[model samples]
Target chain A: MEQRLGLEASIAIAEVVCRCDVDIVAAYPITPQTHVVEHLSELVADGELDAAFVPVESEHSAMSVCCGTAAVGARTFTSTAAQGLALMHEILFIASALRLPIVMAVANRSLSGPISIWNDHSDVMTERDVGWVQIFAENAQEAADLTIWSFRLAEDRRVSLPVMVNFDGFILTHTIEPMLMPDKEMVQAFLPPWEPLLKLDVDEPISMGPVGIPDIYTETKQVQQHLLTQAYGPIVETLNEFAQHFKRTYKPIETYRSDDAEVLLCTMGALSETAMEVVDRRRKQGQKVGLVRIRLWRPFPFEDLYRAVGNVPVLGVMDRAISFGGPVGPVASEIKAAFYHREQRPKIVEFIAGLGGRDVPLSDFGRMFDSLYTTGETGKIPAPTIIGLRE
Target chain B: MATQSAKPKWTELAVGTAITVPGSARQNRTGDWRSSRPIWNHEECIRCGVCVIFCPEGCIHFDQDQPGYPSADLEYCKGCGICAHECPTACITTQEEEE
Candidate 1:
């Protein structure tokens, strides 16, 4: 049975992890991400969850421990934030390369220098090429649901890659929202015990993560790349299976009132909810504006994004992270590249907003929509605008 | 001995490129990288088995023909000169490879 309860998103996510029957929870405590591991430790300590709670000295060790445990066929998990995620950088690549299906919840936060402990996509953007299956959640409910889904998607035989569930630090992690909490039985039925395709066993005596010499290194990378790219099909199939079992539909790219519109605003994470409200307000004022929220960030849903945009002439892409000297923001750059070869594509206006825990109020979204409407008329894509930047 | 076989295609590689076969490291002949070979003077050799113990690759062993004299298995010896340096009797010497 499922019961609705007002729960902090981090705690909710921890509960979902418990229901998944994770074998090991190895993590270091970082702000925003701290509560998640904290609650998980409590669950293990209080005897509510039967699992090994490894209190690692650092985030790097946390991920390294997950790799070892998962290699031995243990359903492993971990969580971290900005600097912590960065600390786990090198191991993140090894986890994916070794095909360890470890599940991680990243409380998306900004990187340092003029140091900040606030929410942003900077942390995740830094590891964009780490080869993990990354996804974003729009709210607490989605965060909790996606955490469970991540484990399923990652452990699939055809897609044995680690999965990172990204939800804004503080904003989504600390906020309390009413969500239908599914019982252990429900989650068990939806996600069966992980059946690893290969594991480290003394009886079988197989070696993992061996050295690839020059002759075989390229072939090894080619195989890994092929597996990652082809994981798209398995991701969709797993999501579909979850939807059928849980009665909650989730798509790679979710659209709100974008079936027929002249302009659309693209966003990810919790900001998409605010964007949805802005779309509603704009529609009431007789403007054909809608919203496009990307749920999948890696093995990016290029086809779904194209199908969602349809013939919309203008698109306002909101990014929470800057790509420095390169193309304004990482998300916008990807969107541009996805449509580069197309004969017909939307004129994308990139907007960098809500960085470093800065508030992205409804009015900020209103300004983006207004700028998008102007771009629709002028047909000139302006420079990437930094929202609420006083300078 | 490590033999070089034709590399497997990307499609033929196992999942995660895991070497499913245990002890596959033996297939890589490390001696190919050696620039010098070790020459043992059996006359001064003490048969203390010091060279056999000091060889990094453990390629040195008591010769079957000589009963106790140590000989290097050139196939796997990396010519690291550890045996020459560690030989207490100074019986082992290193010679530069010509080919």
Candidate 2:
């Protein structure tokens, strides 16, 4: 049965993970992500969920314990944001390399110089090449749903790799919303018991992380990369399977009223929902604008992204984080490269907004569409622009 | 700049390929890199097991028939001379490998 409840997104994500019957959860506390593990610990303490919630001293140890549990064929989980995720950077590569299907909730936060614990893509973007199957959730319900889906997809025989479920820090993690949380039996039907590809056992002990020594280092990485690339099919299949079970459908690149759109706005994470509202308001005013939200970030969903833009004459890609002194922004640069080989492509306008938990007002989104429409009419390309910057 | 002609065939490891040996490092002989070998002076030995405790490689085993005299297994030992340095009796000596 689907239960509708108003709860913080972090708690909702924990409840779903509980229903999934994760074997172990190990984490360290950091802002915007603390509530996730706290709730999981509460559930475990109350005996409502039977699992070992190991509280480690640092995020680095948290991730290491998670990898240890996963290597021993336990369904393991961990959560972190910003600096905490950065601390786990070294182990992040090993988790994927060892093919440990450990699920991590990265409540995305910005890097600090100003020491702000705020929402941005800077954290997960830093781990873009860590080889985990990564997906971004735009809202609380999506966050909850994806947490369950991650384990199913990550542990799939064809894709025995770690998965990162990234949702915007504070924006979604702290916000309370009416969420349809699935029950245990329903989730059980969707995900089966854990079947690990490799495990540490006395009877059948196997070696992991030996000296690669140049002769096989490249081959090892080649195999890891190839497995991830081939995982694209299994990803789609699992999403389809989830939809059939829960009646909640998801797409890699979701389109909003783009059928007749001349200009398109693209984004990821929680901001995409805000972008949708702006697109709706502009559409009501007959602006012919639409929105595209990227959910699957890893294997990049290139084909779906290309199909979603669909020759829209002007495309405005909104990035919540900066690539800093690089071309446009991360998302915009990737979009441009995606369309580089195509003859008929849209004139792309890049917008960097909503860094460090700052709100990007609906009016700012309006101004961005105006700039994109102007670029379409004048055939003059604008420099990669920053909106909502204080003068 | 130098380039190798052959590359790893990426197609071979499609989905479930693992780059690991599993269970044992017996296939690898790590002792070949040792510059010096530890030699035992049986006459000066005090059976305090100080050499056994100080050997970083833990390759030394007590020769029970010789009444608690510890000896080194050279196959896995990368001679660091920690046993000789820590031996209270000055019984163990490090000699340069002849080859």
CA lDDT scores, all candidates in order:
0.90, 0.87
Model 2 CAPRI rating: incorrect
Kindly report which residue stretches of model 1 are placed more than 4 angstroms away from their true locations once superposed. B1-5, B64-68
Report the number of the highest-DockQ candidate: 1
Q: For candidate 2, give the lDDT.
A: 0.87
| B1-92 per-residue lDDT for model 1 (tens digits) | 11134567777777777878778677766788789998878889879988888788888888644676778888798888999999998998
**Tens digit of per-residue lDDT, candidate 2, span A203-300:** 77555554555655677787777788889999999999989988999988999988889889998988888788998999889889998889999989
Predicted candidate 2 versus true structure: per-residue lDDT over B27-93, tens digit per residue? 5567988989888888998778888887888888898336568888888778899999999888889
Residue B10 deviation, candidate 1, in Å?
A: 0.8
- The list of candidate 2 runs beyond 4 A from truth reads B1-23, B31-99
- Candidate 2 clash pair list: A207-B22, A207-B23
TM-score of each: 0.96, 0.87
Clashes of 1: 0
lDDT of 1 at B72: 85
The Cα error of candidate 2 at residue A38, in Å, is 1.5
Instruction: State the lDDT of candidate 1 residue by residue for A91-137, as single tens digits.
Output: 99999988999999999999997699999999999999888999999
